[model samples]
Target: MPLSVVDLYRDVLPRTNCKDCGFPTCLAFASMVVSEKLPLKNCPHIDPETAARCQKELDAQHAAGKWTRRDMAEDALQWAREKAASMALTDLPERIGGRLHGDGPDRELHLPYFSEFIRIGAGGIRKENGEPLNRWEQVFVYNHMAQGGRTNPTGNWKAFQEIPNTVSKVKSMRAHVEAPLAERFGGKAETLGRAAMRLGGRDLTNESRAADAVWRFTPLPRVPVMLLFWDRADEFDAKVTLLFDETVTDHLDIESILFLSERLTQLLCEDGTG
Candidate 1:
């Protein structure tokens, strides 16, 4: 099918996230294949029939020049635009956990982000002050369009590892997110709390368990991130556990979750908050 990547990898792939294919995960490989980033022969595990079919499909895709990173990113952006524009202005606030303003075409979808309300609409997003966002922050806008949430955070949170499809990405998540978080504020309990609070996160130390510091943040409306830190000790390794609302996948894919976590870590460290 056109929606698939050559159709051979789905059933034949080992799904092992082995980087033998030059991609971190098999899913990433599939996306790259669909984007024509790698040829099918790189996997080395596919049978001759599958390999040949993959080559044929790859050729077809390349001939059309339809599957490139730039092409796909543009497509995703266009999709976000269309989806946001097509959504019913009135129902958006309730459906996606954002606040709506105005009526008809003048309506704007506003979501709480860090310390501000990001205003989004068919014309694209801007800050409450009408300033534009960099490409990095635009992911939040795209996610807001794609999210299909209808409920609120249930207050129950779990680590990213608890989420489906994130099992294979745990190591990378740690390296990019948890590790940095721990490095910066693992033993500095006060700094951790201060940085989190700077991000508009609420300190929930009194309500949480076994945590040196715990802060809750609604980074993107329905999407909440819980920063839970266990201070380093002689008996225990220092750790930073980022937990998400149990229903996070209902609003975003696992990749988006990873993106948010990694970006949050980077922001905290780079902004000198961590």
Candidate 2:
């Protein structure tokens, strides 16, 4: 079996929160070594002989393509494709709010993804411009299709913790979606607002909570996400919070929702304004 990050941290590394390895924790270093291709020799505390043995195993695993993040993502996309294959293309228009085009083997659903659109067919998911989607984007769209989009947005928003079975993903929501936005747009509400609006988001600052900036976005026809941002204050860091419609799970699961929010962050940050 290939050595996982956890296995490397627990079985090989010292498991100390030592910063000697130029990482905040041994587990962080282990994760980088396993997933990000960080050299194991970077950890000064590990014995040279043990490091050699583990590095050799990691090399063999990499050579065999048994331990790679891209491989895992591709596997996930394949699984989602299988599930989405069973969905009826004809029914997707009303279920997910997309236009069906072509006929027979050339059929596909052209669904609005933020400000852009994507083409989903039996072959694969791609951008409306005929650009192929990455594994993560493909997985997100496929999972959305596989869910059948059973319900519409209720317009009632709730925090990430308010959603069922989402306690584990709260940290991920902050790290991947909230923190990055807060860091990028803190004290720059105008820039953030412009970027948000560029992606078809609506300004809701007047009606929402006492946030410095508030925007609601409909990435999908049925999936609405609201973002609330606060500028940095005395002794308090800036913050960004996301709220989802109460019926969001009816269209997408928690994992897909996280990915959706992360994608939103990516788009807003890529707007090149701030």
- What C-alpha lDDT do the candidate models reach, one value each? 0.75, 0.86
Q: How far is 268's C-alpha from truth in model 2 (Å)?
A: 0.8
Write the residue-wise lDDT of candidate 1 on 1-274 in tens digits: 3435545456757788779888888887877777755776788677888778757866776676765556544565566566556666577778776688877777888877786788877567788898876554566467666675687789788888888788889998999999988888767888776677677889889987648888888778788888888889997778988999998888877766887787788767765553
In candidate 1 the C-alpha lDDT for residue 139 amounts to 60
lDDT of 1: 0.75
CA deviation > 4 Å runs, candidate 1 = 1-76, 82-85, 235-237
Best by lDDT: 2
Positional deviation of residue 26's Cα in model 1 after best superposition, in angstroms: 32
Best by TM-score: 2
Candidate 2 local distance difference test against the native: 0.86
Could you tell me how far off, in angstroms, the CA of residue 117 lies in candidate 2 after the best superposition? 1.3
Q: Which residue pairs in model 1 clash with each other?
A: none
